[model samples]
Target: MTNNLSVVINSDAQQVWTMLREPARIAQWHGWNADDQEAEINEIYFGPNVVEGADHTSLVVDGGDVFTLKPVPTGTEVSVTRAAIDHNSEWAAWDEDITQGWLTFLHQLRFALERHPHGKRRTFFFSVPGTGGSAIENLGLSDVPAPGDPYSLTLPTGEEISGKVWFRSNHQVGLTVHNYAEHGEGLLIVADQPAIADVRPDGGSLAIVSTYDLGAHQLDAIRNYWDKWRAENYPTSDPVH
Candidate 1:
């Protein structure tokens, strides 16, 4: 058996295309959970993660499907035309699972990346699925490691983060994010060590770190600081979005 579906996103063609290729973003719309996302792009030919020096997301399970993606005039054309599906023979039938899941994740990706676009920095967190650590989710301070602390921020990712205005190097800000469950270290794996700038989509210089090279002290600061920043700068996430 085979399956294919598409949804037109209200975003620029380029932005839609970019999200299709990003495993992190793709997993959100396609993976099991919205709060925790992890998927890597891969090549079917060799089951390789990298192809021609670039990476792709793939899920090749026994009796799984291979999905081929492309950008078409209509939208990002995703063809399930490739891959073998065994239904009960190879894998369980998860049609509703696939249809609703991928479409939703793609829509969110369209909204986020299209308007914001790159050249600016953005960060998101993905927790270990079903790991309901109070500190991890920031559900209540009673369970949090350093409640009522400054320079710490809890993110959607499993990474507990923290940052501080460095007293040295002209107050060059520093940050740390910890991915305890280790799903691609949240979004930190992209690019080099956290990039710091005064870019003002969030008003003035809010330090955005790449989370790749963070340690304990740095993670502490992000966890402490996130609420402070959200309280002061932006609105909290929508209950639904």
Candidate 2:
């Protein structure tokens, strides 16, 4: 089955098109990459069958995923269309996940273009068990949000951030982290990672994809805080991750 997602970015089509073709820019906005499995980005866009256009890029993967940019009066209309899935193939099992993954990346493209145009990001990653009962509650988020509502959260580390909710699902929450001053904003994704059972002790990963250079000390401080919080909240039975 095919699936697609679209967003109107507040930038010109040429600018957005440039970001799509550049590997470094793609890393800033998309989740799936060809490497770095520890995080969501894996460099999948650089595949050989890729076709680049004035405002589009068509790639053949899991069938074919076409990325296009249409010029609008305001900016550009960006979309990713996933071709029909071949059920007999190995990619069949990953159909839904790939669709959702593209959705996440498309929104990320809009977020990066609209919010942090020329900013760079430093990503922090960690995982915890999925059996926790009060972890989401303890994070000071009373509930998940739809596409356009305000969401304010206070992390277990006592860092507070407030911004409009980007997207949320039963197993994931994506929110704009708006506390970076002039440096750059952030997209904080808290999601379950059931597919990666081989990595951690059956849990999910927290991705703080931010567009600021919060330095090593500050970054490590937050990472340590999250690790400590995870240790206290999710005592894993296995010694993985």
Which runs in model 1 stand beyond 4 Å of their true positions?
1-4, 10-17, 24-36, 39-84, 115-241
Error of 1 at 46 (Å): 10
The global C-alpha lDDT for each of the candidates, from Candidate 1 onward, is 0.33, 0.64
Q: Write the per-residue lDDT of candidate 1 for residues 15-71, one digit (tens) a residue.
A: 554555565544433333334334223332223442321333232322244444455
In order of listing, the candidates' clash counts read: 29, 8
lDDT at position 30, candidate 2: 69
Cα displacement (angstroms), candidate 2, residue 231, comes to 2.8
lDDT of 2: 0.64
Candidate that would win on lDDT: 2
Q: In model 2, which runs have C-alpha deviations exceeding 4 angstroms?
A: 1-4, 32-43, 54-63, 127-129, 133-149, 169-171, 180-184, 193-206, 237-241
